[model samples]
Target: MPEIAGYRVSRVVGTGGMSTVYLGTQLSLGREVAIKVMLPEALADEVSRRRFENEARTIARLEHPHIVGIHEVGRTADGLPWYAMPHLPRGHVGQRRLTGDPQRVREILRALLSALAFAHARGVIHRDVKAENVLFDEADRPLLADFGIALRRGHGTRVTMTGLAVGSTAYMAPEQARGQQVDHRADLYSVGVLAWEMLTGELPYKADDALAMAIQHAQSPLPKLPPGLRQWQSFMDRALAKSPRKRFPDATQMLAALERVPLSGGSHGARLQDFAYGAAARLQRLPKPAWVAVGLVCAAAIGLGMPWRHLAEDVADGEAAPASSASSPTDASSVSAAAMAPGNGGIADGGAATMHGAAPLSVADQAIERARERMRTGRLATPNGESALDSLLEAVRAEAGHPQLAVASTALLDALGESATGAIVAGRDAEATHLLQAAARVQEAASPSASARANHRARVDKALRARIAIASRRVNRTDALRLVEHARVAGLPDATVQQLRAQAERIPDLQGRDPGNLDGMVVLDGATRPLAAFVSPVSRAGYARFAEVTGREPALCRERISLLRVLDRRDWTTPGFEQGGGDPVVCVSWKDAEAYAQWLGQRDGYRYRLPTTAEAASLAAAGGARIVSEWRADCTANCSRRTVAGASWRTDSASRTLDPDRGYDDVGFRLVREL
Candidate 1:
């Protein structure tokens, strides 16, 4: 990696057209950081360099918790300017599974909007508010990143490439797409697009190319939500208004509007209306004797009409009005019949059955009520028969066709979604997969319409896919294989399951067997023969033995200190942390690992060497959870550096190249025997 003046550049984490992001260490104070270095091409342009520096300075001033803070700014040896930020390893919001969980969706939006509101107050417009820019910290709190394209007030847009659109095309607002002078509202529009994606698992607009997408944002009508997501429609409508004026005026207003969004698929009033319609339809089927009874009740109600408005007020306030006062003639007849029926819980106890008297509470109504109670108590799907899911299933079996069924189903789905989200946030992929499957089953059983079923399944599948993607990155081979089959059983599309299976197959499986007794090594099946590899990085005790036998001085250590490299006093034995004899050694150079490999090969009468990149990748994927990165036998950049594969305890990144002769505190190596 090209040396940045003040930061110890590790390897490239991501690369874009204008810049590269490095997972780096800030030598001063020993901090792990992400360093964004402007590409030499972009740096060569005086305007681009100036714009980068100016935005870096401006964004550095933003100190909100949800905003990625710029720690220090400097230039590389080649004079490419770079800035450092806290290295957040939970990945970006784009990688998270957030569909069907409005609580989480709202939480993310609120955090981002709070960040935006803070920046907007200082006259900085993020310009880009897409999913990729919203990153999560280790705690899973979101931080708005990459404000390189942010526009500050009074700075003409010409500083950026003039007439060329800024911001991601997929999330661009109408004004941004038109390249018109924009304000904070444009960012709000982008957030609206993001919200739509989170709720629907697809972008609001899709096209063949960026230009087409931008045009759609500028001209196409806002897309209607699916039937199950209609509660968010009004919120989406105002948030995605094509005209800037029609959109939420600021992040604060947008936050307020998001708060107002109903938690279910439909509004309470809408549910009430559906119930009214369903009741009217059923009323026509009443027998003549029942109609006569209703007529007498109506006469009695008219005799006491003055109390009707007060009863309506009480019911609207969620307080149960007295049955005699609240019930219309029709409701009185329905209640009288319900009072005589046999049921369970609230209905059998005569509590909810007589209230409102809109309809008789069936076994389904009691079961749904129990489900709601279970949900409130957080007994979602555990403890077997007493779970909210169990109650919901009972309600489904009863097939009472209660208006509350729709709301109850949505609530269960949302609860399961939120729980699954919590599991994902906690890095429990297996648990998350199980929860999503539960949600899918519930949707399958409860959703009546083909479209509703499809929509619900799609939502569940989106979350499962995201969870599976996360597992693909960090889970072991066994877990990956399990998830592949689990996903198939969960009824995900066959193509998706097949693709996941294919990816999981890349991770070598140990098949539930312990590693061979060949010095804590595992024998992996090979194309031609068996290959034995260390299941963990070479330990301190093992490396010490090699060094003692060879009588070689510890490889020259050079740690990157702020603005310069200094000879590090620490070595494999004292890598700045207390270590067990079996603990993996750090501060060992690739040369050290290679030398030990040669020594061990001679001693064991076998060819032992650093694993090849492909082997390393497979091993890394199947290594389970690890904190140290391992050196691989892959050379890069004229053999000056070798590949370091695996995730560090602090990062979710895959692999990077480092100098083979220099030891890093967190880098080690594992050996593979060529059989």
Candidate 2:
């Protein structure tokens, strides 16, 4: 251990299970570097030693900036293997989460993906791509490190019976976890898991043990991601698919997918930069008095400059006696003399003296007096409990002419009404509803002259009418439909309209069929282009998995495109997509899928979009019935089947059959470009 040969060891920078990383300087080139030396125990095994040496040599051949640069590799004085790499000045990937801005996350992914694409192109597969393996440089640029587990082409079966999986459990692709042969697609899967963790702060799958986790990855469906992530879901889903072929064909494809995410609008990087600059400018413009107060407080805590006794004496001389207090004549004369003392220089020279004889209060004293008065009357309590309501009433009476306060009072009353309406809808007792109504009335009275007061009253009436409609629907179907029609004229949002319609449709009508059947049904063909103008359908399993990952309901989850394709002309009226262009968009990633659907709505006259999960399940069930075998029937029949080459096709009928001879491994889908 006489300082590794050819390098001057400075200090131990980091240590891992099999190696010790030291800060070093290469004497030959006068360059700083990180020297990683394999542990003696690991080197004791001849096979492990050979593997380590081989990996180090393999890494040395990599030349991408995003990949950690391996400068040299050789044996130490005692025959131990050691390798030197460029020293990265920045810290680990986990450190970036403190700010948790999405832009930084994207930048990290971009660099990592670039590195992966480079390696994949060179026929190298880095089996491990988790956050911990990714390092950051001084400029917050990401650098991939620890290629020890990387598998190179022509490397004969390196699997060992160590009982430990090759990749980290959380980021392992399903096939990899099952000990199946893996390719570059496995690496892409790991990157996808890492990206999901960075953006949403949670893994899509979790279990108590590694075995359970492996099972989840192998058998369980990809989880539904967070709502509003409609843009990221498709990429994430493809990357996390249960089968290797279902994932990106290779790292290059994944990189292209990453590029397609909408980064120009609402980009996390631009927003954060704007926020930081604004905050810095605001800090610079703070008043001098505030700065002085902060400095004084800090100084006082440490018993540094300025005596407490002197500070108290100055305060006493500057503050006037309270109007309710009577001072003795002798004491008053003493105070006057103290203020006029020659040692004080003059009234103009000392601020304390100027206020003394004038009987004017210091700003600090006035502030304290006002605070004390407010405390006595409890006027500062917030609007949560009993004190809040009392304070609200007083504020309204004191500032009746102030439009803002008047509006605030009215808003509070309206919120109360809404809460009551929720409780009633949830099946609370009549007594509880009566109590809530009483509370709303009292709040209404507090701001009688305000415009909000009228709004609150109107809201209460609407809630009552809604409740009546619900009651009528349970008893008489015809009347309920009429009531919902009436509500429509009053300007309800589409969701509300749909809900009302759903309720009316539920009752069995005169035709002997459930009236709800007339509301229409949405059908989705997974292989065909997604419906351009209907609610996007998702598999029930997909929806449940998504909820588990994001902690949000399926309905709230945003839709995304699962395949690469243009919108059909017929699908322009979907919920979220509402744009029109005929370009062959390459990066039209899944999250953008939903936006495209919504955009289609404006081009066409009806709603067009991805089917909801319920709709997707129904369609799948129907298709499943048509095919007489397991959906996983070998790739020969269903060309659209999830497989590596299937990534290219928008749809492949050859994939839909049960006969293995007729299947093709590369079939999948693309959304319709137009109706």
Candidate 3:
């Protein structure tokens, strides 16, 4: 393999407008990375070189869960600026068509919005926010990349290229297409275009050339939303507004809109309003005797007037009046049933349900009360197999008459989402997956525009997504088995299904198998008398487990262990490790490594710490240069990133003390902890 700057080139992964990306492995970090080398032709131009370097520096300043991470920024001997980022195996969003489930597409868009918001908050404007820039990690998690035309506050746009439009033609905002001044809203506008493309498998506008396309975007009427995506018209309208004032104010506002989409109807393609109002219309058309009989039956089943009808009626008619004092809540029958809920948790337990001092409860309140109880008892689903999530979903979508209950519904959904998480922690992946998928299914079927429902539904959907994202990150030899079941039931992706099954067949149950392996652990004297060190260095397998268990990646490791960005030297960057099992990790400062030890110590209830000077001496005596270099917790001469003992990674390689503030790619450490 050809080696450049110590990275062994594997093969070409992709070619971008200004660079040919090579899949390479950093020799020191042992990580796979996409090295965006300035194209051989572009290298001749200083401006092109500056632009290449600018992108690297721009991305290096960002740190977000959803943004692409820049690992290293450097120049080749030929003066071409190249930077490395983690190579996501799943590829970019524009490269892959959105199929199978619309919910997943929403998630991808949500991630984009999140990334944009994060960048915008830091004064970064991703001028090019197209589908091609949104890449997916190994677990199908989205990562925003390619900030080539991005602008950070105080950094002027390229004035030299005036009148020449930048960014992708199909996704550019009208202002950007017209070479007019634009801000973060332009990025959001592009996001809208991507959303349209993902849903309908085509951009909102198309033409024979960039100039024609720009004209179309600048003046043409927006194409109709896809047949099923009519509910998204309002969002699309705001996003594609001709004027910047007409578009969403920023990424945060756009994210809220995206979250409220709820697949715009439901899983089976039915609008929540239609279902709720249809049910209400039925109640009104029925004979009074039949209505009373049916109400009585539902009351017996749920212990309340099936007040969902009133909520639907109120929502269907924006001018519906509130119940007046003279009418009394029970007598009004005009208020949403939720407005008339039994004043204190509903009277379904003993007597006729009635609202006293308070307004009647909304359908949401009843669901919150019922679902809360069921969730507490681990009754995610009923004995007859009815999902409690169904009630919770239906309730949250039906507007609550009172603001407090509306707030309560949000908290209730949080609790239900928490319960799903608890299931995962309890090692019941099947149940957690089932519950979350059930909630997602029920949630997708409804999209009520009421502020209460909109806000609460967004919150609930967030919780479900958190669990799924967590599961995706923690895919390991053991957990992969469990996650496959989740992917299948959730229908999140076929890739995850294939990934889990492939991992189960390939990776073996390795570390932590024995009670005293200590390969991935440290025990301090605080917890126990005797301490032990790892039998070997920490491995890629261990890093995977650490991230999964802690919901965090290690700090400043040379090996990019996770998909998320890491902070270093006033720069937000990432690592790129191809694979390192049994091989010692490098590029970690003593402080960060020590922090990891402390974190594990507290989390696992053990005393984990970096080896002291004496301990390191003994280890080195036994191993005889076993490591590229080892870090000692205490300083021999100076403090603050001063190394006490260890051989350096350089060819001059005599044992020497070095600054700890800086990390050498070949310098790794082992842990010592109380047993």
Candidate with top lDDT is: 1
RMSD (Cα, Å) for all candidates, in order, is 18.7, 24.6, 18.3
Off by over 4 Å in 1: 266-270, 273-675
Per-residue lDDT over 504-549 for candidate 2, one digit per residue giving the tens place of the 0 to 100 score: 6543343332222111123233434323211212222323333355
User: Which parts of model 2 have CA positions greater than 4 angstroms off?
Assistant: 98-100, 159-164, 263-675
RMSD of 2: 24.6
The TM-score-based order of candidates, best leading, equals 3, 1, 2
Task: Tell me the TM-score of each prediction against the true structure.
Answer: 0.44, 0.39, 0.49
- Tally clashes: model 3: 25
Per-model CA lDDT versus the true structure: 0.70, 0.51, 0.59
> lDDT by residue for model 3 over 407-495, one digit each (tens)?
43443344444444445543566667665665455435433235533444444334334444333233234564655565455444566
Kindly give the stretch of ten consecutive residues in candidate 2 with the minimal lDDT sum: 579-588
Cα distance off (Å), candidate 3, residue 15: 2.0
